[model samples]
Target: MTTWSAPIYVYLWLAGMAGGSYFAAFLAERFAGYNQRRLTQLAIQMGVLPAVLGVLLLLADLGNPLRFWHLLAEFNILSPMSMGTWILLAWVAIAVVMNVLYRYEGQHGEPGGRPIHRLNGGLGWLQFLFSILLMSYTGVLLATSNRALWAGSALIPPLFVASAVSTGIAVLIAYILVVAPVTTGKTTEYRLPARLLTGSTEWAIPTRLVGRLWEAEAIVILVELVVLIGLVAWLGSSAMAGAREALNMLTFGALAAPFWVGVVLLASIVPLAFDMMSPGKELARREVFRVALASSVCVLLGALFLRAVIVIGGQL
Candidate 1:
């Protein structure tokens, strides 16, 4: 049996989850209506938890969590880990401020409820910027390592971004399905704020939002697949046979089943099919909800698997 270290897996999982959740919140806030405040709040709460935990896991792996403070005291932009730590701190700070603003606005309730609209707008833009940083840092963290398999791959950052976006969509879909039903009793016509989350309503979603999100996810997944295939092919052609063999393990070895079946087919392809089907105006609400939920779960699993395979392959 191959002995796996729990700390490494924990780091990978937490980073992906944190990155994915932030990306999801950022996107929903940009495109969705009235629900932006709620979604932003959710993003802050959800994103912070994973980030904090992931950092702790990384510290634990070092065997002395207190030593982590030393890294903060010393500033080194050239170091990928150091850069990532700074970025994470910025992201957390911005997210917290945004969440607080969102809460304050929610409490007042009106066009003139709060006077921080301009500040909120600025914070929203800052949130998006930090989100991109957080998403890309995961790939940078791995790529900077001396490991041959992880280094020299410029595709890693984009791949991480794509995975983050795909996973974000999945999280949004799941959130909507679970929470949208409760809003049926709300008499007010839902209007999503500029920085809040939104969902399909009255048993039907706006065609534009649903269609756009699905299309974006499809493109991201396809691009990710292409990158993975190209990377494998390149590795095979190189003199590093060990690296090539390790990459192949992802396709034909123990990780093959999850990579091919769970991540590729079930997560990307199946969801694409459902999106393409467009069950129509007459489709049952329950059926639509089920499809969305299932696709979300698959995407989440795929995101997790991507990091898992990479981390394991590096070890091999």
Candidate 2:
């Protein structure tokens, strides 16, 4: 067996998680009316770190990190990595702006109350748009690679999106549960206090919004599984069976546990079950938190495994 460096895969996983976390946090804050200050703050803070690290890892993997300026000095729209670099830079800028706005709003209490909130609302939409692009670009970056398995596959972007959504939900849910009392100032009530006390005619909206995002991600996961299986079957039957066999080293060999258990069963199936069963009621709070946290960790692991398997499989 030939050995290979796998830091790039790790970087990809981290970047995807960061992007997804940003997307989830932005959407949850915008649509759900969920108001845990620490939750949003933590998400914003943690989300940027991975993207920065991923970029650094990419540079390091290139054997000369200093040469990174070449990407910007000489732009190439045709290159996915080049495109990804620009997209990532743009996303970093947006995240910084959102962070500043968030802090400013907290300190200043929104100009004239409603007008400042309105401006924040506009900025919130921009944040969400950029977050989605940040998450989607990871897939686009991989899909742009000339590698046969990664190239020209419609399913890759969606799969990456699904993975992002899954991990994003996970990170948000974990943060909410971890810092619930600090944000809500009530340790006893399991339901998000932000929803109940806000009185905005939009109570329980964030929970429902999160639930819907989870459901959409689950659907995408199903589609991804189907596509991956179909590709394996088709490759096995065609002259590219050797390539298919190497890929199966992921499914049936080394990476099987993570692929089946973490990705398929834990990240996708289990979350779908909980999401379908949970009602936006205080009674279901414990169960909702439990499932969300569990699935989020599983999805994070699955995302890592997905990249690891692909990079390793390709080298094989």
Candidate 3:
């Protein structure tokens, strides 16, 4: 019997996405400084929404949203399901707190005062750690499972983590593109405030800030592609008959269309091409954002399809 349905597949994807975007933004906050302030704010603003949505989906998958608390009340060190439940619960709770902190800063803070709270620095680290764990938990669950497609596969965890970061970067880039205007409008339009992060302002592009997101996104995309290829190879050559069957299903059988088109082409090759060929610094500011928006949309679509293949393929 299939243990997970389509909703579960979607839940897994959204959960990883939430973790990735939140983690990357805070990480950039540390390295990119004030230039990336909007990135951090937007990331925090977005981080919790998906997580909340994923949780609702999870409850729906359970067939009894009201009984979710029963699962929370128990612990099973031996069960991946048990551990995933707690990790997700903690991740969502932390995200809520972090989001509230960011909102509070946006509304009550002075024009020139400190933007983020020192307490959030500590919370941010915790959030970062949990995000990594949350992303990895999905793969770890599969790798430890009895299914021939997932069992004993070492690449699964890193593959998921890389995809999470890749998708996360896409989300932030898309958010930046929409929130921060690049048109040569009046200075007041900048959301990247001279003192705060806004949607309309920066007459000149923050090339370095955008560059950081791009470089990181490209690197993770490459890593995900490598791991994905390695995973296919590993499964194809496995001694297990079930593993080999799963490989065939993915490579040339029923799952081939989604795996090849959605995961391989859309997720890895095409998006990588567009994302890396980013508009140059001399390019018109509006054009730069256009490319980013395209990349983000492609990456998100690919990510959703990736989990669909993984979850469904494993069962087959």
Candidate 4:
């Protein structure tokens, strides 16, 4: 019997999240004019681990793990798997180069670093493009399958992209909160009364960008929320029985608890509510970071749950 296991789901989640991280970091550093140093550093760090880990997981999941090397030897422009392998290989090389160049400039304090940095920045565009393709390829890989649940709708790729971005922002936010220093006396801190009606008493007020980062996270989360709604709606309306079954599994089947509580409630809504608590205004930086950290954790967990549910539910 054919089966997709936990490792496959993990590979999918990691690949998407990594692609999202690279794309998010690239955009922030390139066009948004954010803290290029920090963003680039985060990008390279985030990209490398996932790129390596995803491949490892993929290999382990294969029945014949050693056969993985054949991917490089094989060349089929028409094969999604073959193309994805090439993209993955290229992406890893770019990530390593970025990491090396960034660290070199930092250690040597090279005055000529400007031109080198510029060249590296130019490569960032390639990273972004590869990221987009890599993220979409996950959905395309599944959709090309004969499985009705996977092939029923054209929205999977876009949905995956949105989710990838949302999770990517979460990962970046967590990294920033952990690594970046807190600004002292930068803004006044204030707290609203806790929602007694809702049960919890903790209050949160968001402060904008420790420089320009958090704001971007909020924007991506919002976009993901919108795309998520469309994804569900599209899937629900799909004429295929497998699609309906898959949707049912998510909404009211064995996977319901994890899908709703883990993915929908904790992952999507909670973070969204936290971000909306204070938008574009400066408040307590620590408090904002705390809330953002909480959101990031939830988003990451939710992202993992999403892949598990989709992979398993589709088959059922």
Clashes of each: 11, 2, 8, 0
Cand. 1 TM to true fold? 0.80
Q: Candidate 3 — worst ten consecutive residues by lDDT sum? A: 186-195
The sequence of per-residue lDDT tens digits that candidate 4 reaches over residues 103-146 is: 65554445867777877777777888988988987777777777
Which clashing pairs does model 3 show? 179-199, 189-200, 190-200, 190-201, 191-198, 191-199, 191-200, 192-198
Score candidate 3 by lDDT: 0.76
Quick one: best TM-score, which candidate? Answer: 3
Model 2 ranges off by over 4 Å: 1-5, 27-43, 112-123, 182-220, 230-234, 237-243, 270-288
The reply for model 3, stretches above 4 Å from the true place, is 35-37, 106-116, 185-207, 279-284
- The global C-alpha lDDT for each of the candidates, from Candidate 1 onward, is 0.65, 0.62, 0.76, 0.71
Those runs of model 1 whose alpha carbons end farther than 4 Å from true positions after fitting are 1-6, 24-41, 109-114, 183-211, 279-284
Pairs that collide, model 2 = 32-206, 170-296
Worst 10 residues of 4 by lDDT: 190-199
TM-scores, each model vs. reference? 0.80, 0.76, 0.87, 0.85
TM-score, candidate 2, is: 0.76
Task: Answer with 2 or 4, whichever has the higher TM-score.
Answer: 4
- Candidate 1 whole-model C-alpha lDDT, 0 to 1: 0.65
Give one digit per residue, the lDDT tens place, for model 2 in 1-316: 6243467777777777777776666665645565544345456666778878887888888866788888887568787777778878877776676666555555555454456456656666665676677667767776675555555345566767667766766666665555442324432332334323232222122444445655655665676567667656654555543556555666787767766776667656676676556545232356666765665566667777777766666556
**Model 3: per-residue lDDT, tens digit, 1-316?**
5788688878878888888997787787677566435555566667778888888888998867888899978899777778888988888787677666655655565452255566556677887888888898878877788888777478888888888888888887776666665555522122443235332334333546665777688778899999998989899788976988899999999899999999998888887787657745222355655776787888888988998898889887
